[model samples]
Target: MSSTATPTVEIDPQTVVRKVTRNVIPFVFVLYIVNYIDRANIGYASLQMNKELGLTSQAFGLAAGLFFIGYFLFEVPSNIALAKFGARRWIARILLTWGALATAMGFVHNDFQLITVH
Candidate 1:
């Protein structure tokens, strides 16, 4: 009988870290900035939207507050989903879903609709 042998390769941890940081960090940073801009855009829209929707300041405030409340409630589960689904799929799903919801916001006619959309 002949003996069989397998070869093993070693990886450099620092090199892996450097490559990950270089490749991933810039994309993550840009995504964060875009997300911030998207979230902040509602405030700017409120100038025209409040009058058009006939939303009282309090109602608008509540609607705005609910966005963050929903975010808080969903954050942990979303992170868990990201871990389960992997980043590319999870992030694409998030972007598509939020993009649809953002588009839907433009069609809302009243406080109830705005609240529901948020």
Candidate 2:
């Protein structure tokens, strides 16, 4: 009598890459592009918003500059924590915070309010 285990299926690496490229890369690229557009839309709006809000160019510039400050301060640690934890939960937290701050900027009545809250 001959006894042999049945062979398992094998997946090809090129097939996997092709699948990822076809299925995943477009969504990822679109998401990144949208995220950037959402963030920068504020700056584009600020051009008109500053005049309406009575914010000086310097104040608007400061507010815009602070976005990077927050990003810089939190980015590395947030990425590290995400690596230690997981992408889903970590990204959710980051996006939540980002969205909240972004929304709050719309509500600022003055530069002082903007500077203080942000």
Candidate 3:
């Protein structure tokens, strides 16, 4: 039997960094944009929604408070999934979930319902 030798190739760190930045930064930027837009719109939406849903200010305030609770609960599991599955696949999974959730938005009726959905 004949033994074959493998050659090692050295990659430039700057090129590697550029490539990673190109791939990773845009997605991170998008995540930030989506985050801020959601925050702003939720504030605007809650104002209108409180009037339409007949939510007491206290109830609306409670709903806003719970938003962070839900965010904290989901953030860790989602980040774990992102690390396990890779960004492209994890992002697609998130989009699919949010698409289904967006459809469910039509069915909410009252403060409790809206609070649970949010």
Instruction: Give the top-scoring candidate (lDDT).
Output: 1
- In candidate 2, position 36 carries an lDDT of 82
Instruction: Estimate candidate 3's alpha-carbon lDDT, on a 0 to 1 scale.
Output: 0.77
lDDT-best of 1 and 3 = 1
Full candidate order by TM-score, most accurate first: 1, 3, 2
Error of 2 at 110 (Å): 1.0
Please report the candidate that would top TM-score against the real structure. 1
- Tell me the tens digit of each residue's lDDT in model 2 across 24-118: 67655655765786578766877787888899989977977886797699878988998998765666666666567667777878888877555
Off by over 4 Å in 1: 1-9, 13-30
| Candidate 1 clash pair list | none
Error of 3 at 102 (Å): 5.7
Model 3, TM vs. native: 0.72
Please give the distance, in angstroms, between residue 19's alpha carbon in candidate 2 and its true position after superposition: 8.6
For residues 8-116, could you state the per-residue lDDT of candidate 3 as single tens digits?
9999999999988998777667666655655665588776777889989999888778878988899999999999999988886776565455455557789888788
lDDT of 1 by residue, 9-118 (tens): 89999999999898767657766765776688789999998998898999999999999999999999999999999887787788777767877888899999999988
Q: RMSD in Å for candidate 3, one decimal?
A: 3.6
lDDT of 2 at 59: 90
